[model samples]
Target: FQISLPSLKERVQDIPVLAKHFVAVFADKTNKAALEITDDYLAALKQYTWPGNIRELKNIIERSVILEEAGKLTTDTLPFEITHTQETGNLSSFDLALVEKQHIKKVLNYTKGNKTETARLLNIGLTTLYRKLEE
Candidate 1:
């Protein structure tokens, strides 16, 4: 008898449970108890075409847990292919600088105009945040 499990893409409904399980596993292994994940991030994960299947999702969750800070995971923790790719088209020809600027602005807004926290949340340096704001 053989039992077959579906691919990550086919088991999208299971992502949240699987993601939490992976996060807990990685977090305990890494000594980092942070295990927060945003709804948008899970939604993106569900929609993504997982060529690497379960292994891919495991890696993604592990990486996200490893990089997670402030006990929360946002869309920024997602892979570039998942975040930068738009439904309308790819970002190959897109103005990434503008995108960065907009992202900074959004994060800044999210952080309530706190430059230091915004920089931390965006995973950029204080100087870089200042420079981007000036640009």
Candidate 2:
């Protein structure tokens, strides 16, 4: 007979239980009991969109444990970008043309559409700015 292990997302509710188990295991291995995971910490863990699943969660927990001093785990222990996106729900982008366009617009407005000043403010050559603007 064979049994298959459950995927982390399917077992999301088990995070707290697993965390406690990890605490015990790590404490015993390291001969330390200074770390305690708080309810808020667990809630954040539950809220996170774990794209990389259990392995990612375990790595994060280990990192937090190593960094934390004796006390309850705090939101600070979690990665900043994760927390930021979770809280603010901002759109992430990688469109270079869009970014350049936005920057050019802002600099142009700030300089009252003065091409020379906009170029200076943008730290780019005037010809480059003109080329970008043409596009």
RMSD of each: 5.1, 11.2
* Candidate 2 per-residue lDDT over residues 1-135, each given as its tens digit: 999987776787998887777766666666677578887788888777777777788777776676566566666567654444554454364356755776687668657789999999889999999999989
10 residues in a row with least lDDT, candidate 2: 82-91
**How much does candidate 1 score in TM-score?**
0.64
State the number of backbone clashes in model 2.
Answer: 0
lDDT for model 1: 0.79
- Judge candidate 1 at residue 129 and give its lDDT: 97
- What are the models' TM-scores? 0.64, 0.56
- What's the CA error at residue 132 for candidate 1, in Å? 7.9
Model 1 clash pairs are none
Pairs that collide in candidate 2 are: none
